[model samples]
Target: MAAWLLAPQFTRSCHRQTPLTACKSNLKNIGTALEMYSTDWSGHYPPNLNLLTPNYLKTLPECLNAERVTYRIATGLNAPLNHGRFQDYYLVECTGTSHQDVNIPADYPKYTGIMGLIEQ
Candidate 1:
């Protein structure tokens, strides 16, 4: 009888977990695609995530439940022509969970600038 009573609670918790798991998977794939893109482009990272599509990635992965996942590359005209060699690159995913958002590569190099996302 107690197991039956707990079943519904368990199911609800599982349902809530699904999107979070999928979001993490998407981040991993995006990271792989970025690595490939860097290799092909003389170690330069894509200016935007869309640049990876149909070449490095078949199609960009959508955020599971949040608005969208964001890609931020810290490179510029005078920036060194290499990803991770001299600059900081990051991916941010807004979550459906109460945690708000999570940044891929949780660790970052010292003195990295905060790249803000414009509210849409």
Candidate 2:
């Protein structure tokens, strides 16, 4: 082995870390929103983020820092859990960030914004 510094760019960790950090931050915020939502209605998550917006959050927290925000509402989704009612729930998640190193990508951008089953 020659010298570690004398290599032709072994790897670039910065690129990977930046996005992952941002993704993690978004996840934490989303989780907090989910928790607050549960507290408001007793074990029930908001049907969607917008429901929390203007309430749990004054305005959307800007999940992704990309063009067009890359964040949008993926509508017509199946209820996240067994509410035992006629399609009475919904969900929204963050996107446009990556966490490949830990295999926990934020959601959306990579998954094409399809979190769960959705119907009109």
Candidate 3:
């Protein structure tokens, strides 16, 4: 007969591993949410950071990165150049890629993000 045992260290390792794995998971979700918003004809991008939640992340064990969202915005800072040129929109992940405090909007309850006009 073979017996299987998990060492105490393994337990600790699992605890440690969970967050990192979770963080990655959260990041992926953030990316996915942005993708969804991009396709949807919302007439704009996802709402501001203050409006995000798990509802956005279909992938369980949420992990979001809030700090990154603002900086990403700069990527699309320049938009709406011409007189009749419709401004471009952007999908951002401001939070820390974790579901820490993703605002839960009744409508798009998951992804908390910002939308801005930018140039192609």
Candidate 4:
């Protein structure tokens, strides 16, 4: 009886989490594409995400659930760590979410690349 009563609540929560999970996975894949692009271009990230298509990325990944999400590139001022390169960059995503504080990392690039996906 208790299980039946609680099923609806669980279902509701799961629905919300599903989109968030998809968004996170998308962001992580974007980050991977960015990293690969930088490596091929001597540590300099592409001018925009579109540049990754058909090469580094097959297609631009969409925000799974959120609208008005922003992907930003933070360029490291220091010289490139690789051979005679010119730039270093970090990737971050600011996505729309249902909750205020459900931010999680994509766990890639050895840095905290995924930013908060706040309620819109």
Per-residue error (Å), model 1, residue 42? 0.8
Give the per-residue lDDT of model 2 (tens digit) for 36-109: 66666755665455665656654454533442233333223343333443332334444534333445544532
Across 42-113, the per-residue lDDT of candidate 3 in tens digits comes to 444444422223344322232223323322221133422223333444433323323334332221222223
Best by TM-score: 4
Provide backbone clash counts, one per model. Answer: 0, 0, 23, 0
Q: Which candidate model has the greater lDDT, 3 or 4?
A: 4
Q: What is the C-alpha RMSD of each candidate to the true structure, in Å?
A: 13.2, 14.0, 14.2, 12.8
Please provide TM-scores, in order, for all candidate models, with all chains considered together: 0.50, 0.44, 0.33, 0.53
lDDT of 4 at 28: 63
Ten contiguous residues minimizing lDDT sum, candidate 1: 1-10
User: Model 2 segments beyond 4 Å from truth?
Assistant: 1-17, 68-93, 96-120
Whole-model lDDT, candidate 4? 0.47
* Cα lDDT tens digits for candidate 1, 77-109: 333233345354544333334224443332221
**Candidates sorted by lDDT, best first:** 4, 1, 2, 3
Give the Cα error of residue 93 in candidate 2, in Å.
4.1
Candidate 1, residue 59: lDDT: 61
Candidate number that wins on TM-score, 1 or 3 = 1
